[model samples]
Target: MLKGLVIVCANGCFSSMTEANSKVKALLAGRKARQCCELLVLESALGKGGAPWDFQRGSDFSNVDPFAFIVLA
Candidate 1:
């Protein structure tokens, strides 16, 4: 089966990580994008220690597009 992947950006300059997370969900639900199994956040959003937010919730999101993640940088 073909899985999907999405590159979500969160510079934290204009948008917050939470907003970026919302955007990622939007992209997954977007019609143009493919079936995303993973959602990678930019380095700026995820700090070195990965403090701030827990993107782990996305793992069980809908489960319609396979698995997902917010890879720690």
Candidate 2:
């Protein structure tokens, strides 16, 4: 099985880690993918150096497609 911690972040921002994790889990609750991946949230506001608020700034996905599929080793 492909089990890993899927760290999710918003194009905007989330206030807390708990809130981010819960919201993502709730959104994916009905999906089978949720069963294999452990959901996590990147608390941009609390991280070191912080994260960019604008999606176009300091973001790798700024010019990419709307969806992404990542696998962690």
Top-TM-score structure, candidate number: 2
lDDT of 1 at 56: 68
lDDT of 1: 0.46
lDDT of 2 at 32: 84
TM-score of each: 0.34, 0.40
Residue-level error in angstroms, candidate 1, position 54 = 33
Once superposed on the true structure, which residue ranges of model 1 sit more than 4 Å away at CA? Answer: 1-10, 30-35, 45-73
Report the lDDT tens digits of candidate 1 across residue range 22-45: 666765686544453555554243
List, residue by residue over 18-53, the lDDT tens digit for candidate 2.
Answer: 666677777777758777766554432233344434
**Clash total of candidate 1:** 4
